[model samples]
Structure formats: structure tokens, C-alpha cells
Target: MAVSLTGTRISVVALPWFVLVTTGSATRTGLVAFCEMAPYVVVKAFTGPLVDRIGPRAVSWTTDLASATAAAAVPLLHVLDLLTFPLLLVLVAVIGAARGPGDLAKEVMVPEAAEHGRVPLERATGLSGVVERLASTVGLAAGGALVTLLGPLTGLAVNAGCFALGSVLVGLALPRGTGRAAEDPAAAPAERSGYWRRFGEGLAFLRGDPLLLTVIVMLGVTNFLDAAFASVLVPVWARESGHGPTAIGLAGSVMGAAAVGGSLIAAAVAHRLRRRLVVLAGFLLVGAPRFLILAADAPLGAVLAVFAVGGFGAGFVNPVLGAVLVERVPRRMLGRVNALGDSLSWAGIPLGGLVAGAAVAAAGLVPILLACGTAYFLATNLAGLRPEWREMDRTRGRDAVKRRAPA
Candidate 1:
């Protein structure tokens, strides 16, 4: 997870800076991002069934290793004087492809790990969230320092190393006989369908379960708003506010640090909360105040305060989502289901970046920030009105179903 968290943060921050510096066009930078992410979403959607079929442990390490190799190749080519814009695009796309499956594997492991230890899924998921936030916190700070001191390629180097390290950890650290393997005897039934058919079955599950569908849509919109804010507005706002690139980097680090704090707190107390209500409140906290605070054109201290609060709220979100997913998905289907849901949730990101770039260019930073934040707040809350969210139970429902199966 550390490798994943650090590697992703480094790539995300470093890539944009590299493109912006080299190409000198925000739109073009966004297009590079779009090229990497669009294919990422599409490919990951199909890979979910494969994960379920093959199991997550293999999926995680293999993909991480592949991603590391691709990432390492980028700098080697650059140093060899063979790198070009198109080549950079292809390298980043490869990283994206690997990252999608790697992410699904990690998420699928959370519940299983919890069950193996006789811990609640919420608690385990909270720890997962903390790991992510802590990784972001450390990675963002390191990314800033590396980019500022050693340049963007240095950050990319760190990213590649982290992916390689994460692959090693996943391959070696996790014990066998965790999570879902404890519950199901019939999970790996004789393969009755082709890989494509099984993948379609996963999609069918999403289509039939309105609760899961709503959660996916909600997460998708939230991801879109976050991408717009992070990729476009935050950097532009920092420059316009006279903070420059260093300040942009620092702001990200600060937000990530606050998120880490939030997630750690969540890990300590996540079991006490009611999932549905907390999620609604978290959305309100995370979404409503960001644009308003940014538009206020506050001082540096005030800006940091606003982001800290927003990040804290965001920290509260992921664990609940993770727990919900783990509890509900059959062990055999975890990879495919997780991949599908995650792909849908992340699908809006590239477009969000593109839209934010256009909006910032046309409408200026503050107004667009306000509008996007407001839209995110509204969309998330509106999603909560659906009956499925309230009806779902992360604990009792799936466990009861498992118990009822014949011995």
C-alpha cells in the first residue's frame, strides 16, 4: 500500500509538472492525462472478472511489477535521448493500465484480511484508508521536495521504486488463508463459462443491485469533482494567489497530511459509526466548503485550514466504501466486482480535468471552483435519497447469507 500510495501520488504530481513545463499548454497537458486515463478506465473494467477468476494476490503483485518496469523505462529512455512526447504518453498509459488492476487487488484484500483476524470489516477498511492517506501525505511531501530540488524525473524515479517495492511486499507479506477463503468452500466452482461470460455476470450483478449502482454513481461524481479541483483549479489558484509551483506542491502535501490524520482517527473509531449517515455527512463536509473557501480568496493560512477540513471529511469516506464492498461481494467475485466499481468511479477523472481546464480558462478560477464544489455537494446528497443506501448492511447481511449455506 505504501508503494501504491507513494507511486501514484508521485506520478500524478510529477507528470503534470513535466508536461506543463515541456509543452507549455494546460490543455495539452490535460490531453496527455486524458490519453492515459481513458484507456485505464476501459481496460480495468474488463479485468475485474479476470481478477475474480484468477484471485487478487496474483493480480496485485504481477500488475505492480509490470507498472514498476514501465515506470522505470521512462527515465531510462529519457536519459538515453530516445524519449519523445508520444513515448511518454505510451509509458504513462502502461502505468495506468497496471495501476488499475493493482488497485482492485489491494481493495479486495481489505475485508479478507479483517475476517482472517476476526476483526470488523469497518475497522480493517479504516486502516486501509489510513494507509492510503498516510501514503499520500508522505508521497506528496516527498514529491514536492523531489520535484523542487531534483526535478520531476527524480519524483518519477521514486515512483517507480515504490511500485517495485509494493510488488515485493504484496508478494511476500500477506499470509495465505486470510478473508474469504475461510467462508466459502464452493467459491472456485468448475468453470462453467468463458472469461467473457463471467465478466458479464459481474456486470449483471451491478445492473441488478440498485444499492451497488447508486454507490458507484455517487463515488463517480465525487471522483470527478476531486479531479477537477486537484488537477486544474488548485494549481491555477496557487499561481494566481502568488504561491508559485512550490506552494502548489506544499498545498497538496498539507491536504494529504490532514487526510492522514483523519484516516487514522477513522481507524481508531470506525466501528462506532453508522455507515449510511456518516457517509452522507462526510460528503457534505468534503464537498460543500472547498469552492466557497477557495473563492473567498483567503490568506494562505485560511486556505490551508479549509483544505484540512475538507481532507478530513474525505478521509472518512473511503473506509466505509471499502467495508461495504468487502462485506457484500462474494469472495470468488471480489476482483471483478471491485474492478468494475472502481473503474466506473474513476471514469469521470480525465473528462473532469478537461472540463476544469476549459472552465478555468473561460470563467476564471474562483467562479468555477464555486460552481464545481456546489455541484458536487448537490449531486452527492441527492444520491443519498435512494432507499438502497439506507437498507444495506455491511456486517449482518452477508454473514447471515454465508451461514445459511449448507455445510
Candidate 2:
């Protein structure tokens, strides 16, 4: 999982620079990003039931192999001077489409893995977050250096290699029956259901749960904002500030390193913390400030400090959310529900780069940063005040009691 994610992060770190340098157009860069993520969300949304029906393990390995092929083709074509802008978009889109299911399949495996390993769900998810942060730190650092020194294509090639390795691991390393659905009498009825029926079941579950709905909505907005920051805003800052790709690597590495520390701490103690407080504080620290700080043209030291602190705060969020999700949803419905929930939360991401690019082209970087920061602040803070948010904390207590109750 870490290897696969690292590959993805490397591409993510390098792709914007690749497009920006190749085309010398921010809009084109945004368009390329949009091409990739739009299909990813859409394909993942529809593939959830398929993952459940066929089993996540098979889906995971297959899609990783597909992703590896598509990612590898980009550099191979570029080397032959056969890669046009349109061709590049198409290849990226393929990678995104394959990645969507691959990512979802892996996520579905986590709860089962946690159970098999006898770890708490929160701790397992926290460890997952740590893996992601560590990957991001290493991948982004490597990507920045590769792009700055060797060029972006090297990063893409490494991404392909990682995907290949990930496919092999998933196919060979996991215990047999690891990702198979658990034996439950109720699961027979679900297995008999058609794809659309299963999808509807997942949607109905989400519609009835106000807390889950709220989390999805809040995350959708925040993810959109984050997408913009990663794809357009940060790269633009690096370019305009004369900090170059190395500086981008440094900033991201610092943030990711701090996030790793935070995730480790959360893995150890998050179960004892108030979910609402942790989530709200995490959002408060994670959102807006980095954008605002960058827009203000603060000293590099101050900017790095804000990013590190924000990243630390950001680390607490996913573990709490993941545990709550596992508690609320049944194992049989995990693939579908997680698919629907994640798809909804990520829905806004497709447009994030496109909008940021256009906005920056017209209104300039500082304005876009300031505006996005404000939107992020309102989305996180104002939304937290919603009555449904009380459900977050309540669910944790109820789950604890359920765990402690006599069998």
C-alpha cells in the first residue's frame, strides 16, 4: 500500500511541473489534472459494487497492473517523441481510471486486515495514515529532485515501477481468503442482489446517516480545496517565488514529516480523545492557513512552520473518521459504502485544478489563495457547528460501550 501510494504521490508532485514546463501554460496543466481525477472519481463510484461482487483482492491486483501499464506508457511515448498534449491527457486519464478502483480495493482490505492482525480499527487506520504521510514525504522529495535534476519523466517511470511492485505484493503476499467477505447469514441476501440493487443499498445507508452525510460533504469541499493547493496553487507559488521544484519538495516534505509524527501519536492515543474535538481542531489547523501564509509572502521559515503544524493537525483526522466509519458500517457493505462515501467526498476534486487555474489566470495567485483559504475556513468551522456533528462524538462512546458489552 505504501509503495503504491508513493508512486501516485510522485506522479502528483511531478505532473504539474511536467505540464507547466512542457506547455508553459497553467490552464493546460489544470486541464491535464482535471482529465485524470474526473474519471477517477466517476469510475470509482460505479465500480464499488463490482469490487464487492468480485472481491477486493482481485480487483486490487488487476487494477494495479493496469495502472502500471498506463503509467509506464507515458514516459515510453515521451522518449519516442510521440507524446502530444492530447495523448498525455488520455494516458493520464487511463491511470486515473485504473487508480480509482485500485485505491478503493485497498481501502476495503484495511478493516479485514485490522481484524486479522488483532489491532484496533483506529490504530490500523492511523498506521495507514502514517504510511501515506511517509510516502508523501519521500515521494514528493524524490519527485522534486528528479524533476529539478533529471526531469519529470523519471518520476513517472518510477511511478510505473512502484505500481508493478504493488501489484505483485497484493497478488502474492496476502494470506489466502484475506479479502473474502466474512461468513454472515445476512451476506447471502446481499450476494444475491444485483449491482444496481447493491449500489442503491449503499446510497440508502448514506442518506439515512446524517453524520456520514455531513462528513462526506465537509470532506468533499476540503478535498477540493486541497486538490487545488497541491495541483495548482503550490506549484504556482514555487514558480513565482523563484523557489523552484526543490522548494516545493522541501515544503511538502516538512509537512508530510510532521504529519507522520502526528499519525503515530494518533495511532497510540486517538481512541482516548474526543472525536469531535480532534476532528475540529485538525480541520482548524489543516485548513486555510497555509494558503493565507503563502499569499502573505511570509518568510520561508514561517511558511514552513505553518505547513508543519497544519500537517500535524491534519494527521488526527483520518484515524478518527476511519474508526467511526468501520463502527457505523457493516463489513458486508464496506466496499459499496466506502466507495459511495469516498466518491462523494472526492467529487469536488475533479474541478479543483481547473477552477484554480482559471481563477489564477484571471484574478492572479494571491487573490485565489485568499479566496480559497476563506472558503476552507468557512467550510470547516461553520460546518462543524451543525447539529449533526454531535453524532461524531456520540458514535464513539456508543461504539466503546458495544465493544465492552458482554458477548
Candidate 3:
């Protein structure tokens, strides 16, 4: 997961610059981004049932190989002077389409992996979060340096290499029976069910669970806000502040580094903490402040400080969420349920860049920043007050009962 995500982060950091430098148009950059993410979300939404049916391991390896091929073609075509804007968009779309299921396949394997390794779900998920943050830090920093010193294409080449390596690892490193749906006898019969029927089952389960629904909705909004911050707001701020791409890399690396530390702490101690308090505190720290700080136009040091705090808070959230998700959803429904949930949470991402670009053009940076911050603050804090949030703490009791029960 970390290796694949690192490749993705590198591509994300480099792609906009590649488009902008080549076409000299911000609109084209946004267009390319939209082409990638729109297909990603849409494809992922429908692929969940397929993942459950065909098995995550096969889907993961195959789709990763596809992504690697598409990614490699970009630089290769560009070097041969055969790349056109339309061709680039098509290739980007291909990558997005392949990545959608590829990512979901990998995600649905986490719980199974944790069980196989005899690790607590929360601690395993926290370790997963740490790997993600570390990957993001390294990838973003490397991308920035590569783009500055070599060219954006170098980053793209590296991204292709990462995807290839990830595919190879997934194919060869995992145990033979790992990630196969039939490994779970309870879920095996469902593999014979039609895709739509299985998808409907997953949907019915999700719809019946208020806590899961609430979590999904809250994350949807927050993910949108975060997407806007990373894809649009941060780049604009860097340019406006005369800090350049290096500063963007610096800010992201600092935030990611802090997040790594926070995830480590969560893995070590979160099992002993109250879920409600930890979740609420984490959300409060994670949301709004980064936007507000940037709007305030504080010194670079102050901005970095706020981001560090935010990153730390952000780290606690995913591990808790992941554990909650695994507990609430049955193993048979995990793929479809996780796909639906994640796709919904990520639905606004494609529009984030487009919306931010339009809003900035009309209303300027500070107002947009303040508006996003206000929205983020309200969404996260207000959601915590809902009754469904009680579910966050229920898992421990349920687990204890199961452990004490006869096999």
C-alpha cells in the first residue's frame, strides 16, 4: 500500500506542473486532473462487488500492472514527440480507471492481513496510516526535488517504476491463499451470487447502519475540504506567497512527518483511550485550522506549526475509522461496503480543484480559505454530537464478549 501510494503521490505532485509547463494553461491542468479523478471515483464505486467476487489479490495485481503500463506510456510518448493533449488525458483516464479497483482491492485486504498476523485491528490500521504518511512525505519531497532539478517527466518515470514494483510485490510476496475470498468459508457462497445482488446486499447493510452512514457523510465533506486544500489552495498559496514548489514540499513533509509520529503514538496507546474523546479531539485538531492559518497569512514558521498540529490530529482519525469499519461490516461485505463508503467519501475530490479554481478567480484566496475553514469546522465538530457516534466505543465490549464466547 505504501509503495503504491508513494507512486501516486509523486504523480500527483508532478502532473499539474507537467500540464501547466507544457500547455501554459491552468484550465488544462484542471481538466487533466478531472479526467483522472472522475473516472477513478466512478469506476471504484462499481468495482466493489467485482472485487468481492473475483478476489482482491488478482484484481490488485492485474490493475496495478495496467496502471504501470499507462503511466510509463506518458513519458515514453512524450519523449518520442507522439504525445498530444488528448492522448495525455486518455492515458491519465486509464491510470485512474485501473487505480480505482487496484486501491480498493488493497484496502479490503487490511483486516484479513491483521487477522492473519494476529495483530489488533486498531494497531494494524495505525501502522498502515504511518506507512501512508511516511510514503507521502518521501514521495512529495522526492517529486519536488526531481521536478525542480530534472523535470516533471522524471517523476512520472519514477511513478511508473513504483507501480511496476508494487505489482510485482503483490503478486509474489503474499502467501498463496491471502486475499482470496474463498479463504473465508462464510463468504465463499456469496462469491457465486450475481454482482448486483451482492452489491445490493452491501448497500442494504450500509443503509441500515446509522453510525456507518454518519461516518461516511462526515468523511465525504471533510475529504472534499482536504482535497481542495491539497490540490488547489496549497499550490495557489505557495505561488502567491513567493515560496515556490520547494515550500509546498517543505510544508507537506513537515505535516506528514508529524502525522507519522501521531500514528505511532495512536498504535501504541489508542486501545486504552476512550474512542469518543480521541475521535472528537482528533477531528477538532485536524479540521479547519490549516485553512484558517493560511488565510491569516501567518509567518511560514506559524503556518508550519499549525499544519504539524493538524497532521498529528489527522493521524488518529484513520486508524479509529478503519477499526470501526472492520468491526461494523461483515467480512463477506467488506469489499463492496468499503468501496461504496470510500467512493462516496472521495466523490467530491475531482470537483475540488475545479471549484477552488473558480472560487479563487471570483472571490480571491482569503475569503475562500475562510469559507472552507468554517465549513470544515462545522462539519466535523457538529457531526460528533450525533447519537451514532456512540458506536465508536461499542467495539471493545463486543470484541470482549466474542473472545469470552465458546468457539
Candidate 4:
């Protein structure tokens, strides 16, 4: 997961810059992003049942290989003078399509990995979050340097290589019998029940859990804000401030480093904490402050300080969410349920890039940043006031989750 995600973080920098410089238009940069993430969200929603059936291990390795192929082709074709804007869009779409299931596969495998290591689930997930932040730190710095020194294509090629290496690791490094589909009472007979039925079961489970629904809804709004901030607002800010891509990378790296420290603390003690309070507190720090800081015309030092604080707060989030899902969803239904939940939360990601670009074009950077910051503040704070959020602190186990009716 770290290997693949690191490469993805690099592309996060390389791909946007590639489009922005080439087109000299923020709209097209976001259009390219839309071309990628639209397929990611749509395909991931429908991929749940398939991941459950075919198994996440196979899905992980194969789709990663496909992503590598598509990612590599962009630079290769560009070098050959065969890469048009349309062709680049098509390749990125393929990468995104492949990535959706591949990423889900990795997520589905997390519990199995935890069990194999004999680690507590919350700690394991916290460790996973740490890996992600570390990836962002290393990959963003490397991406910035690669783009600055060697060009964006070089960074894209490195992403391809990372994907390929990740494929080899997933295919070979896991223990025997580790990545097989989870077996349950529904397993044998459900083979004949067909895909839509399985999908419906997952949806029904999610709908019955108001807490999970609330979490997903709140995350959907915040994810939209976050996606916009990362993909457009920061880049534009860097350009406007004459700080360039290096500053963007530095800000990300500093935040990511702080997040790693936060995750380490969470791993040691978050399980003992009241999850509802931690989550609300984390969201408070992670949500709106970064956007407002960027809009403040503050020095880079001030921006980095706010981002580090936000990053520290971010450290508490994923571990809690991962532990919640693992505790509430049966392993057999994990792929479908987790997939649906994540897809819903991520639904606005593509639109985030698109709307941020269009919003900035109309209103300019500072106004859009302020508006987005306010929206983010309202989303998290208001969501925290809901009764369902209290369930975040309730204890749950797979046995308890299974006792809940499929209805």
C-alpha cells in the first residue's frame, strides 16, 4: 500500500503541473483531474461485489500492473510525439480506472495484514496512516525535485516504476492463503445469488447504520474541500506568491512529517481515547484552517505552522475510521461495504477539482479560498453536533456486526 500510494502522491504533483504548464489554464488542469478521478469514483462504487468475489489479492496485483502500463505510456508517447491532450486524458482515465479497484484491494487486505502481524487493529491502522503520511513526505519532495530538475515526465515515469514494484510485492510477498476471499455463511450459496444482490446487501448494511452514514456524509463534504485545496488552491497560491512547486512540496512534506508524529502518538494511545471527541477535535484542526491561512497573505512560515498543526490533527482520523469499519463490517462483506462507503465519501473529489478551478476563474484565488474555508468549517463543526457521531465511541466487534440483520 505504501509503495503504490507513494507513487500516486508523486503523480499528484507531476500530473497537475504537467497540465497547468502546458495549457496555461487552471480549468484544463482540473479537467485533466476530472478525467482521472471521475472514473476512479464511478468504477470504485461498482467494483465492491467484484472485489468480494474475485478476491482482493488478485485484484491488487493485476490492476496495479495495468496502472503501470497506462502510466508509463504517457511519457513514452509524449517522447514519441504521439501524446495529445486527448490521449493523455485517455491514459490517465485508464490509470484511474485501474487504481480504483487496486486501492480497494489494498484496503480490504488491511485486516488480514493486521492479523498476520498479530497487532491490535487500531494500532495497525494507525501504522497504516503513518505509512501514508511518510509516503506523502517522501514522494512530494521527490516529485518536486524531479519536476524541477528533470521535468514532469520523469516524475510520471517514476510513478510507473513504483506501481510495477508494488505489483511484484503484492503478488509475491504476502503469505500463502492470506489474500483469499473471506469466507462466511453467505459465501457458498451467495455465488449463485449474483452481483446486484451482493451489492444490495452491502448497501442495505450501510443504510441501516446511521453512524456510518453520517460519517460518510460529513467526509463527503470535507473530502470535496480537501481535494480542491490540494489539486488547485495550493498550486495557484504557490504560483501567485512566486513560491513555485518547491514551496508546495515543502508545505506538504512538513505537514506529512508532523502527521507521522501524530500517527505515532495515536497508535500508542488513541484506542483508549473517546473516539467521538478525538474525531471532532481532529476535524477541527484538519478542516478549514489551512485554507484560511493560505488566504491570509501570511508568510510561508505561518502557512507551514498551520499546516503542521492540521497535519497533526489529521493523524487521528484514518486510524479511527479504519478501526470503526473493521469493527462494524464483517470481513466477508468488507470489500463491498467499505468500497461503497469510501466511494460515497470520495464522490465529490472530481467535482472538487473542477469547481475549484471554475470558482477561482470567476472569483479569483483568495475569495474562493475564503469561501471554501467557510464551507469546510461549517461542514465539520455542524456534523459533529449530530447524535450519530456519539456512536463513534461505542465498542463493536465482528460478532456484533454479524448479529445485525442483513436488512
Candidate 5:
């Protein structure tokens, strides 16, 4: 989780600044980001079974180390006068590819860690959410300062270091035999089945499950909307409102801090919360008003406060989703399911910048922001009222008791 938060913070947060600095073009900056996320979504979709077959812990460490290497190479190449746009694209793409597995590995680890320690998945998931939110808060603030004080390269350097630290932590911290033992012994023979067949099994399971499918779809839609919000809103607000990059960074930090606070609160009371309603209400709160607030272009203080509130709602989101995913899938299939869900959930990310750029060009920023916000708000709330959502809502109260029963 630490690795995910920090690594993503640098890659997503600072990489844009790096591109802008080097190229002086928002379109080019967005393109660099597009390069990273596009491959990431593609690789993650297929890598699920591989993650299940091997183990998330091993994948996490190895990929994180690789990410560190890839990220570090950018600056090193720049220093060597070899940092052409093509080279930067390739390196960033590699970093994005590595990040796919790295993120899934970390997410997969959450359930394992909870199960191994006999912790409630909801509480554990909340903690993981807190870790991510906290990292974003710190990383955004730090990335901003790092970029401002020492340039974008320094921020990238810091990102590499964070990945290195995260790799070390995951590699050393997990139990020695945990990764291997988590694999299904009976599946050793099936592992030799064609890769496509194995991949089909994962897909088949998702197809068979109604609740999981519903959640996946909801998240995917939300993610696409979020992509629009994140990619377009910040830059527009920064440019139009006279907030500059520093304010942009600070806004992210405020959101992260609010999210962290929400996660901590959720962790404390997670046992009592209904998983579906909590998630639904969070989505409602997070999606619409915040975007409208941004679109309104209020005073700086109001913008920050609005984002902070939005972040709080977002903080409530991940833990519930994580707990649901962890509980729904068997440990053996966790990696594949996690990767699959994540891929769908995040598939909208690349489109975020691209769509945002086009939207801004075509419709101008304010109207687009309002449209995105309205779409997110309506989509999430309407989805929450679905029959499938009721299943999760009904289960949470009774399941919490059963979950806490003695082994």
C-alpha cells in the first residue's frame, strides 16, 4: 500500500509537471500520461492469472523494484543528455506497465495480510485506504515542493526512492512461506493448462457472480468520470483561478488529508457500517457537488474546503470496495480477480487526460467540468439504487457478526 501510494503519487502527480517543464505543452504533458496508463490497463487485464499463479507478494516486490529502476532511468537519461521524447515515452510506458502489477500485488496483499493476522477485512481494508490517502496527501505536497524547489527531476528521484523503500518493505515484511502456500495445490496441474484457458477461468468466475459484476461496472463508470475530473479540473482551475501549480498541489494534499481522515474514521467504525450503503453514500457525496464546486470557481479557501470534503467521501470509498472484493473471492483467485476488477475500474484513466483535453478544446473548461460532475453524481447515485446493491447492503449487518466469530 505504501509503495502504491508513493509510487503513484510520483508517477501520476509529478510526471505531468516533468512533461510540462520539458515540453511546455499541456497536450504533450497529457500524452505522456496517456502513454503510461494505456499499457497499464492492458497488461493488468491479462496478468491476473499470472498473479494468482505466482503470488502477489513476489510480484509486488519485483515490480516495485522494476518501477524504481524505470523511474530512475528517466532522470539519469536526462542527465546524460539522452532524454529524447521517444526515450521518455518508452521509459514512462515501462514504468506504467510495472505499476500495473505492482498495484495489483499490493492490493492482493491486503486480504492476505488480514486473513493471516485474523484481522477483519473491512478494518484492514480501511487501514490500507488510509495508507493510500495519507501517501497522496504527503506525496502531492512533497511532489509540489520537490518540483518547485529542485525541479521535476528531483520529484522523480524521490519517487524512485519511495519505490525502492516500498519494494524492500514488501519483500522482507511478508511471511516467508505465505506467498507459495496461498496457491491452490490442486491447481498445479491446471497451471499448465493453456494461459488463455486459465485466464478464461478468472473471467468465468466474474461472469458467474452478479454482485461482483455490478460493482465492477459501477466502479468502471465512476473511474471514467473520475478521469475526467482529475485530468481536466485541476489544470483548468490552476490556469483560470490563478492558483498556479503550487495551489494545485496543495489542493491535492488537502483532498488526500481529508481522505486519510475519512479512512481512519471508517476504520474505527467499519464493523458497524453497512458495506453497500456506506459505499453508495460515499459515492454520492464524492461525485457531484465537488465537481460543481470546482466549476463554480469560488474563492481559494472554498475550493480547498470543497476538495477536502470530496476527499473525505473518497476516503470512505476504497475500504468498502476492498473489503467486498476480498470477501467475495477465494484467496487462490484473489490476485486474478483483483487484477481484473482493478483493470476495469482503472480503464478510464488514460481517457481522462485525453478526454479532458478534447473537452476543454471543444466546450471550454467550465461547462465541461459541470457536465462531468453532473454525470458522475447521477451515475453513482442511480446505480446505488439497483437491486444488486441491496444484496451487499443486507449482508453487511449480519456478516459483520459472523466475520468476527472465533475460529
Candidate 6:
């Protein structure tokens, strides 16, 4: 997860900048983002059953290898003078397609890893958050420097190398049978069933849970806003404000570093706190403010401060969210349910960059940033008021139960 996600974070920084610099069009930059994430959302949504039946271990490494090939081809072709916009889109789409299943495979293994260690779900997921934040911090900082120094192609080359390394680690480094298919009675029968039937079962499970459904809808909206922020708003802000890519990297790394601290704290004690309050407070801190700050043309220090505070708040969110989902879903159906939920939360990602780019072109960057901030505030607040969210605190896995030490 660390190796692969770090590579992705670098791409997140490099890819948008590459298109923006090369094409000089926000809409085209967004189009490139759309091509990648659209396939990510669609393929991830449908590949859940395969992850379950085929085993996450096999699915992860194989798809990652595919992603490595596609990612490597971008720079390879670009260097050979054969790269074009259409071809770029095609390669990114391939990367996205492979990444979807590969990511899902890695995610579904978290709970089992926690079980083996007898660690609480919150702590386990919090540690996972720490890894993610650490990766982002390192990747973004490095990517920004590499892109600034050598060019975006250098960053792209690094991304390909990371993907290749990720495949090797998953395929040959992990212990045998680490993420093998579940051995549930349901698992055996379900393995024999048609793909659609398995997928339908997952959908049905997800649809029946009001809390999960509500979480999905809220996150879908927030993720869209986030996508807009990361892919377009920040890049445009950097270009217009004269901060450039280095500032973007610096702000992101500060935030991510702070988030690592937050996640560590959450891993240590978040399970003892009221999950609902933590989530609500985290939402308040994470959203709206950064957008508003950038819109106000805040100084670099001010921008970085807001981002750091928000990043710290952001750290508490995913552990609680991950714990909640895994606590409710049976181990047998975990992969599919997680896949569906994640894909739904990410569904609006492709459209986010697309819409933001067009909106920036039509109106301006500040207006879109303000609008995204306002939307984020409203979505988080309204979602908090939903009765279904109370359920977030209701479920707890056996592993999450703390045992008293003998005197």
C-alpha cells in the first residue's frame, strides 16, 4: 500500500501539472484527469466479486504489474516522440483500470491483518491512515522537486518504477497465503455463482444498510469537491498566486505530515473516543477552510497553516470510517462491500476535475473555489444531521474489544 500509493500521490502532483503546462488549457487538463479516474471508479465498482473469488493477493500484484506497464509506456512513448493527447488518455485509462482492482485488493486485506495482530480496528485503520499520509508527504514533496528540477516526465518515470516495485513486493515479498480468499461457507457457494449474482448480493447488502448508504452519498459529494480542489483548484491557485509547484508540494507535505501525527494519535486512542463526535469535528476542520483561504489570496504561511490544521483533522476520519464499514459487513462479503462503497464514494471524482476546469474557464478560479468551499460546508453539516449517522457508533468488531490485563 505504501509503495503504490506514494507513486499515485506523485502522479497526482505531476499529471495535472504536465497537462496544464503542455496544453495550457484547464479543460484539457481536467479531461486527462477524467479519463484516468472515470475508469478507476467504473472498474473498481464491478471488480469486487473478482477480488473475493480470485483472492486479493493474486488480484493485487497482477493488476499492479499491468499498471506498471501502462505507466512506464507514457514516458517511454513521450521520449520516443510518439506521445499525443489521445494516446496519453488511453494509457492513463489503462492505468486507472488496473489501479482500481489493485487498490481494492490491498484495502480488503487490512481487517485481516488487524485480526492477526489482535489490534483494535480503529488502531489498525489509523495506522493505515498514517502510512497513507506519510506516503503523500514524501511523494508530493519529491514529485514537486523532481517536476520542478528535471520535468514532469521525471516524476512520471518515478511513478512507473514505484508501480513495478509494488508488484514485486506484493507478489514475492508478502508471506504465503497472506491475503488468500476467505474460507467461509458462503465463500465456496458464492465462488461458483455468476459474476452479476455476486455483485448483486454486494449491492443488496450495501443498499440495506442506511448508515452505509448515507455515508456513501455524503462522501461521494465531498470526494467530488476534494477532487476539484486537488486536481484543478490548487494547480490554478499556484499558477495565479505565483507560488508554483514547490508551494503546492510544501503545503501538501505540511498537511500530510500533520495528518500523520493525527493518525498516530487516533491509532493510540481514537477507539476510546466517541466516534460520531470525532468524525463531525474532523469534517469541520478538514473541509471549506482551505478553499476559502486560497480564495482570499492568503499568504503562503496562512495557507499552509489552514492546510496543516485541516490535514490533522482529516487523519481521524478514515480510521473511524473503515472501522464502521468492516464492523458491519461479514468477513465473507468484505471485499465486494468495500469495493462498492469505495467506488460510490469516488464516483464523482472524474466529473469533479471536468466541471471545475470548465467552471474556471467560464467564470474564474476564485468563484469556483468559493463555490466548492460552500458546497463542502453544506454537505458535511447536512450529513452530520442525518439520523443514520448515529449508527457509526453502534457497531464494533470483536477485535476492537479491549481485554483487561491480569494483575
What ranges in model 1 sit over 4 Å off? 176-193, 393-407
Q: How does each model score on lDDT? A: 0.76, 0.89, 0.85, 0.88, 0.77, 0.90
The lDDT, on a scale of 0 to 1, for candidate 4 is 0.88
Lowest lDDT block of 10, candidate 4: 398-407
Highest lDDT model number: 6
- List where candidate 3 sits over 4 angstroms from the true fold: 182-191, 399-407
144-173: candidate 6 lDDT, tens digit per residue: 898899889989989999999999999999
- CA shift of 140, model 6, Å: 0.5
The candidate with the higher TM-score, 1 or 4, is 4
**Residue runs of model 5 more than 4 Å from their true location after superposition:** 186-188, 191-194, 395-407
**Candidate 3 lowest-lDDT run of ten:** 398-407
Q: List CA RMSD, all candidates.
A: 2.6, 1.9, 2.2, 2.2, 2.6, 3.0
Q: On a 0 to 100 scale, what is the lDDT of residue 82 in model 2? A: 99
Distance from true location, Cα of 86 in model 5, Å? 2.5
> How far is 78's C-alpha from truth in model 6 (Å)?
1.3
lDDT of candidate 5 over 55-100, digit per residue (tens): 7778888988998999899889999999999889899889889989
TM-score of each prediction: 0.92, 0.96, 0.94, 0.96, 0.93, 0.96
What TM-score does prediction 5 earn? 0.93
Residue-by-residue lDDT tens digits, candidate 2, 1-407: 99999998889878898999888888888898899999999999988888887888899999999999999999999999999999999999999999999999999888877877888878999999999999989988888888889999999999999999999999999888887643335455745467888899889998999999999999999999998899999999989999888888888988999999999999999988888899999989989999999999988899999999999998999999999998788777778899999999999898999999988999999999999999999999887899998988788667765543321
| Candidate 6: 10-residue stretch with minimal lDDT | 398-407
What does candidate 6 score on TM? 0.96
List where candidate 6 sits over 4 angstroms from the true fold: 186-191, 397-407
